[model samples]
Target: MDTACGKEYECMLRITEEILLLILDTEQGNIRVSLPAHTRDIVIAGAVLMDLAMEDRIDTDLQQLILVNPIPLGDDFLDPTLADIANATDTHDTAYWIARTAERGEQIRQRAINRLAARGILETEGHGPVFFSRLVSRIRRYPSVDGTDMEDVHVRIMRVLFSQDIPDPRDALIVSLAASCGVFDSLLSGEERAQVRDRIDQVARLDLIGRTVAAALRQHTPSARSRKSARPHQQIPCVAGWPIAGHAFAMSRDLRIFLTRQYQRHGPIFRIKAFNRRFIVLAGPEANVFVTKAEHVHLRSNELWRDFDAATGSGRTVMSMDGPEHMRMRKVQAAGYSSKVIQNRLDDVIDITRRAIDTWPMDQAMSGFPALQRIVAEQIGLLLTSLSPQPYINDLTVFLETLLKIQVVHQWPKLMMHWPRFRQARRRVMELYAALLVAHQPENRRHRHSDFIDDLLELHRTDPQFLPETDLPVAFLGSYFAGLDTSASVCAFMLHVLLKHPELLARMTAEVDALFDRGTPTAQGLSELDVTHRIALETLRMYPIIPGLTRTVSNSFEFGGYLVPAGAQVIIGNTVAHHLPACFPHPERFDIDRYQRGRAEHRKPGAFAPFGVGRHRCLGSGFAEVQIAVTMATIVRETELVLERPHRPIDIKQMPLPHPAASFKIRQVRRRRASGTV
Candidate 1:
C-alpha cells in the first residue's frame, strides 16, 4: 500500500498475470497470455470480459459486450512484466498496472481479471470455485425448471455467465432469472437473436417435454413472422418541396396558416418549408392512407417526436426505430402487451393512477411533468420490473429527464456523436442505466411485487428461449417516457382551455356527472364521455405534441407524380394538417363542440390521428387516454381550476408549451369516492 518508493506501479503490474490465471480454470481451456506474441495478447483480451462476468461484478446486460471482438490487443499494448505485478492484489490494482504498462490487450485482460479476482472468486484449475460454485448451485436450486435436464442446466448456466445463451431446456428458466435481476438486455446481434430462436426450437422439438413452450418463445422472436409487401397506394396529388431556409421563417401560427394554405392552394397535396427540412404536407383521406396505411411507405415521426422531446425527452427510445427493424421490434415487444395482459392489470394501473392523481398538489402551483414521471416509473416497476423505487421518485424523474435530454433534446452534449458533449452524455446515460440495473435488482427478492418485472421474470424463467428480456421494461419505460409529459401537458392544456371557457367545463362536468349517476366510469362510463373525449381529441389536434412525422425514404418510390429520391426524407405535418380549413370548418377555433355528443359527425376518417398511426403507433395510447381521462375527470370532479391571469389575448409564444411557469390554483368542491375504474 505504500506509495513512497513508487513501487506501487511495479507491484500493480503483477496482479494482471495473477488475474489471468484465475479466468482460465479448465485444463484444456487454459492458454499462456503473458508472452510478447501478437496473438497471445489478443487471447488474453478475450478472457478478460468472460472473467468479469464470472465474478458477477458486471450483470448479464453489459450493453457493449459486442465491442470485445475485433479485439484491440498487441504486444506493445500489453508489455507488463510478471515481476512488476506479482504482489499487487485486487482488481483495481491490476487494472491500473495494466493501464499503465499495457495499452490494449494487457489493459483489457487486467481489467477483466481484476474485476473478478478482486471479488475473491479466484479461478480454480479444472473446476468451479467455492464462491462461483456456491452461487451457481443456489441459482440452480431456485426451482425455476421442474424437469429441465441437468446437462442442459449446466450448459445454459455456462452460456448465460458468458452472455451466450445455450438452447438447452433450461434456457427459459435462466433467461427469466436474469431479467428479474435487472440484467440489461444483451446487445444481441441479429445472428445471436436468431441463434436463440433455434435453441428454443430444439427444446420444443424434444418429445413430450411439453409442446407449446417453443412456440411461445418463438412468438417473441423479431423474425417470427413473415411480412407481406405494402399494397400499392392509390394515386393522389403528391407534391414535393425542397426549400432552402430563409433568414426570416414564419411565426408558429404563420407556419400553421401557411400549411393550411398549401393544402387549400394545392388541393389534395402540397409541400412547404418547415424548420430545416421541406415538409410535403398532404390533405384529404388519401394522405392518411398513404402515410399510415401503406407498409413500405412508413411514416416518420422524428419531427413530431422532437416537439415531444421538447416536452418529454424521448427521442432515443426504441420507439424511435423505423422501417422493417422498427416494426419487428415493436411486434416482439407487443406480444407481452396483448389485451389479456392489460385486462389482467387494469386494476393496478387504475389504483396507481388514483394515488398519483390524489398526490397531485392542486393547492399549490407545480409542474405536472415530475408527478407524471413518477406514475410512468411506478407503472414500469409494477408492470415490467415488479420493483418500483419509492423514495427515489425524484431521482428517477431526473434520471428519466436526463435520458430524455440526452436523447430527445440533444442538450447533453452528445446530440452529435462527434462532439465531446455527446461523449459526456454517453457516459452519463450508460452509467445511469448501469446503476439502475444494479439498484432495481436487490438480492433474493424480499421486496418483489407482482409488477411487469415479475411477469417478465416468470415468463423468461418459464420460457427464456422466447423471452424478449428487458425489452418489456424498455417498452414500458418508453411508453411512459413517451406518453406522460405530453398527455399530462394535454391535461394541463385542457384544464387551461376549459377554465378560459367555463361553458365547456360545465358541459364536461355535467357529462361526467351523468356518467357517474348511471354507474362508475367503468368501460361503459368512458363510452358516455364522448363529449369529453372530443374535447380531448380537439386539444390534441390543435396543439398536438409533435408538429409532424418524418421518415427517411429507404427505397425509391413514387407518390402521386413525384419521384421521391431514395435518400430523401419525408415530413407529414400533423398539427398543420389538422388545421387545414378544407379538412375542418373554422379550423383556428378551439371547438371541443366539434366532437361533442350532439355533434359527433365532425370526426372524419383519416382526419383525426392525434397519436399518429400504423404499426409503430403509440402502444400506450389506450393507457394514456385512460390516465388523462381519469386525471382530468378527477380534477374536474373534486375541484374548480382557475387561471390566475384571466382571459385576455393569451399569446402562446411556444408552439407546444403555452408558458413555463404556467401557474393555476384549484378550489375544492366536494370529495368523490374512487369513482373511475378502467
Candidate 2:
C-alpha cells in the first residue's frame, strides 16, 4: 500500500466512512466481512458508484450510468474504480459496473480495514481456534482512538440519521446505503429500530445515489430481478373470497373474524378483495409500527378517507389535509383538548354526565347503548359548543348513523344521498351546524371563552386568513364527528364489560369510591383513579372503537418480504393486533390488571392502538379519557347496576365505530351509598 495514496484517501473520508459502515457492524462491534463474501464487495462498490455520482464524475437518468468526467482524483481506491468505468471499451450500465467491481469486494474490504488500522481509527487482532489438529485464523476489529478504546463511528452515523437536523449528503448517503441493504435490523435495538425505521424510509426517498445503487443491485441480483418482475399487488397472498364481489359480506358480517382468519392463513401481510377492490391488510405490532410511523410522503391519509369527503364537507376539515396542513389544523384544534383546557372543563363533563344519568329510567331495564350515546353526545356538545343537547343531539346521532351506513356501502353513488332519510338527516345536521355558527359569531357573544367552538372562533378572529368564517362550522363538525361516536362507544363498552364481570366492577367501584373520598371530583382527583384508568385502557384494547385504521401508500416499499406498491390501500388492524397472543397473551380475557404497574401489557409498541397512532393519533385522546373516567366514576359512585340479560353476550358491531349489534340493556339495582362511603 502506498503511503501517499493512503494520505490522499484521508480527504475522501466519505468513501472510507461508507466502506466502514458496510463492512463493520458498529452496534455489534465486529466486522461483517465473514458474511457472504460478495455482500461487502457489492456494498463498497455501490458506495464508490454513489461517490462518483456525487462528484459529478458520472450521471444516471433512469437507465445507464453515463460517464461525463473520465479524469480521476488522486485517491488510489476511487481513481482505479474511476479508470475501470472511464477506460472500459464495452458500454456497460451501472449494474454491470457494481457486479464487476463487487468481484473484488474482499480485496476492497481488506484494503479499507488496513487503511483504517494505519490511521489508528481501528485496531485489529488475530486469534486461532484449534479444531481437529487444525488452527483457523480469526481477525477481530475494534474501534480505537490514539490506541485507546473508543465509541464506534456507526453510532455517529445513526445519530445523524435519527437527528431532526438535516445531514450532509455524504452522511445521508452512508446511512441510506446501510438502510437500503437492510443492515439496520442488525445494527439497532428494537426500540431504536422503531424510532429510526421511518427516518430510514425518508432518507431512502431523498438519497438519489442510494436509490440508484439499490435499483442497480435489484437489476443485478437474480432474486431481486425476479421480485421486480412480479407486480407488487400479485406478490401478496390474497385471501380466498368471492370472484368479483370478494369478501365484502364476510368483512361486513365480522371484520375481526374475517381479518384474523386471513392473517392466520396468509401471515401478517395479506390482501383481501372486498367491495370490488383489493385491500392489503397488515396485522400485528410490526405492521402497526410501519403504517403509523411511516412518513406522510410514503403513506398518505387523505386518499383513504376520500369516500367521507362529501359527508365531512370539502377541504373544510382536517381529515382532508395531510403533512404540514394537517399539523397546522391539529395545532389549532388541539388547544380545546389540551390538559389545561380539559381540566377546566371537568366540571362541565361531570355535570352533563350527572344530568344524563338522572334521566335514565332507573327501576326498569333499559338499553345501555342509546342512553350512553345520548349522554356522551350531550357531554361532547357541552364541552365543544357549550350548548344544550336538547334539539340537536337526536339529529346529530341520526346524521352520523346514516353517514356511517353509507360509508359501509363503500360505493359512493350520487343517487344514495337523494334517499329521503339520508337527505333529511344530513339536512337536519347541517341546519343545526348553521344555527350554531350564527349564534357563535363575534356579535353574538354570550360566553366568550366557554367551549371548543369559542376557541375556534377566537383563532378565526386572530387569523382570519388561516381559519376562515366558512371553515369554523367545518372545524366544529370535524371535532363533533371525531369525538361523538368513538367516546360514546368506548364508554358503552366499559359499562358492558363491567356489567358482565361483577368482580372487575366491584374493584372499579371501590377504586372510584376511594378516589372521591380523598377530595371533590377535580381533575387532580380523577387522575389518581388508577383502577378506573386501567379499566378504560382495557376496554379500548378489547374493543378498539375504529377497529382498523386505513391508509393509501403513496410510495412503493417493501414490507414482510413483499413489495407493497404505491396506490395500495393498507389496513392496520388494531383489533386484530390487540387480540394477537404474541402482543397480549390470552387476549380474549377482559382483565384490567393487564394495565397495572407489575403487568403493563399496554406498554408494548403498537400493542394498543385504540386511538390510532403517529401524526394522526386521535387528537381528542386526552379529552376522551378524562370524559370516560369521569362518566364511569360517577356511575360507579352514584348507582348500582346489573346486566339486563346475563346469559346473552354483548353483541358488538365493529364498523364506523364499534357499537352494540343490538341495544345493551342493563338494570339498575339500587342507589349506592353517598360519595364519602365505599
Candidate 3:
C-alpha cells in the first residue's frame, strides 16, 4: 500500500505462523537480534530484554526471535547468527570454542549461517553471495582481537572450509556498542540516539577499513548477562559481547590489578570496568586529543563529581560545574592562583617550606613523603592567606595517605544522593566557605586587603555575570583540596628519585647552587637553572602526577578511528600513554636527558600533559610545576637525603597517595658532612 497515493496504507508487520526457529546465538544470550520485517528495528529497541526473556517462565509467548545479537538489545529471543559473531569476542571466545567442539554443533551451525550472511557465505541476491573460496579470501582480510595471532578456532574454520583470515575487530566492536545503546530506547534524547547511530556507522566503516589496529581501538567486550535492579546506567548494554568486564560486585580485586596489568601489557587506552560502568583508561599524548581537543566531549567537573558522589555519597562542594558556567567562574576567579599570581604568595611558600625543613631534627629521619606533605600544607595555607602565617603551617601539612583507603574510596559521599546525612555534610562544607566568601567581597570591611579572595571579590563586583554563587565554594574548595596531596606526593617521589641516584641529584644540585649561593633557594634561581628544569621533566615522566584522569561522554565521541557511545566512562591513562613507544622513545628507561638532551624538541605540548587535557585541563598545572621544581631544587641544595629504610611495595592503585599513616624514613645529609652529611 503506497502512502504517497493516499490509499489505505496497510503497514503490514507480517507475523508468519511456523514452529519459530529461535536460535540461541551470542554467548550467555547477549547477542540476540531479530531478522528484518521484525517490529523492533536492529536500530531501535523496547522494554527490558531480560524481563521479556524471563516472562517465558511465567507467560508463554508463541513467537520469538530467540537470542540473535549476543549483546541482547530488547528481550528474550536469542538469534544464533549475530550471537556467534559476538561470542568470538574475548570474554566469550572460550565458551564459543568449547561449545563448538562437536561437529557442526548448534552454536557452530548458527555462527556459520550468520557469518555467511554477513560475509556472503552463500550466493544471495540482496548483496551478492560468494563461494567458500571467496569466503576464505574475505576471512583472510577480516579483523579480530589479536590481528596477528591466528587462533585455533579461526585456523580450524579456515582449514575446515579453506584458509581465511580473522574478522575485523572494529566490526565486532561496532555491533557490540550499537546493540548496547539500543536498549532503553525512549530515554536517550533524539540527538544522542542519532550520535549512537552515527558511531555504529563509523565503527562499521572502520571494521572494514584497514589492519594492525591498536587494541584500544579494536578490542572491546559487551556484557551478555542481566542484572536484578536493571538501572538505566547498567542497560548501557555491552555490544558484540565486548568486555564490560566487572561491575560493583566484581570491582575489588580485578579492577586495580587489571589496570596495572594493562599498563604492563597494552600501552594505553585499553578498556576497563568499574562499579558497572565500562571505562577506557588512556595515557600519554594520544589521550590529549580527548581532554584538550576542540571537540569538547568530556566528563565535566559536575559529572566527575557525580561519580565521586556515587563513590563518596556526597556532592556540591565545588569542582562540579561544567561548560560555560565552569569557564565563567574560573575566568573571573583564575587570577588568584595563576603561576605569576601564586608567586606573589611565593614569599609565603618559601617561608613555610623553610620553617618546616629547618625545624626538623637531623636525627628525626623522616620519609620524603612527609616533607612533601608539609610542603603541600604550606602551599595550601599560602593559597588561603593562612592565619598567623607560621604555626598552622607545619601541622596543616597532613599526610592524607589515609584518604586513599579502598573503603573510603567506595564510600564516596556523592553516591547516595537519597541519603540525608551525606546531603547535609555537603551543605555544611559549602556553608563554611559561604561565610568566608562574605569577607571576600571588596566592599565588605573584612576584605580591605587584596588577597586572592579579596581580588576575586573585586572582580565579582566589577563584572555583573561573574557572581556565580557557586563560584566561591568551587574556587576556594577546589584550590584548597587540589593543592594538598597531589603536589606533596609527587615532591616526595621526585626527591626520593634524586636522593636514590646521587649523580643525578648532584648534577641538579650543582645547577641550583650555581644560580645562587649553595643553599639560597628562590623562584628566580629556579628559572635560571636549565639543568634543573630538564631533570624536573624527567622526574615527571618517570613518576607522573595523577597516574591517569577520568572522563565520561556528555555526548557521543569519535576517537582513535572508533565511535564511543555517550555516557561510557573513560579513563585517560596518562602514565601509560607517556610510556608508549609512539610518545616516548625507550619509555621504560628513565633517562632525564630526553627533555634536556639533543632531541629536547621532541617533547610536544599535549604529549607530556601530566595536568591532563580537553576542557577540563588542570588549572593549576603551571603553578604546580614551578612549586615542585623550586621546592625540590631547594631541598637538594640544602641537604642530601639517604633512605634509612626502603618503603614496602607501593600500591599503584592508590598511587599519588597524599599522606601516609606513617612518615617515610630518610637521614638528612648536610653539605658539611659528619655522618649523615652530604
Question: What TM-score would every model get versus the actual structure?
Answer: 0.51, 0.65, 0.54
* Deviation in Å, model 3, residue 571 alpha carbon: 1.7
> How would you encode candidate 2's per-residue C-alpha lDDT over 183-252 as one tens digit per residue?
6665666899888778887766666776777778766672343443434668688778887779888887
**Candidate 3 lDDT over residue span 1-678, tens digit each:** 001111111111001000011111111111132222121221121111112222231111122223332453221123332344345433332222222332123233333334444433222111111122234335633222233322222233223222233333422322332333332132234675564554444443343111111121122122223434423433332322224435433334333334445655654345555545667555445666445533243454455555433433333423555655555444444455567655555555655666566766675577566567667756764565332213333322221122233223343333344455444555555554665666554456543435556655565568635454444444455555566666766676676667667788788877766754644445565677776777677766666665555566777644544555667677665555566656677877767777765676335545675555554556667677778777776576555567766454332324323233344567865633232222
TM-score of 2: 0.65
Give the lDDT of residue 620 in candidate 2: 80
Which RMSD values do the candidates have, in order? 23.5, 16.5, 21.2
Which segments of candidate 3 are over 4 A away from where they belong?
A: 1-270, 282-284, 298-301, 307-318, 345-347, 383-449, 459-471, 518-524, 601-606, 646-663, 669-678
The positional error of residue 604 in candidate 2, measured at the CA in angstroms, is 1.5
- Shift of residue 372 alpha carbon in model 1, Å: 5.0
TM-score of 1: 0.51
Per-residue lDDT of model 1, residues 359-396, tens digit only: 65545555533454566556545654454545545443
Q: Per-residue error at 495 for model 2, in Å?
A: 0.6
- The Cα local distance difference test for each model comes to 0.45, 0.69, 0.45
- Cα RMSD for predicted model 1: 23.5
Worst 10 residues of 3 by lDDT: 12-21
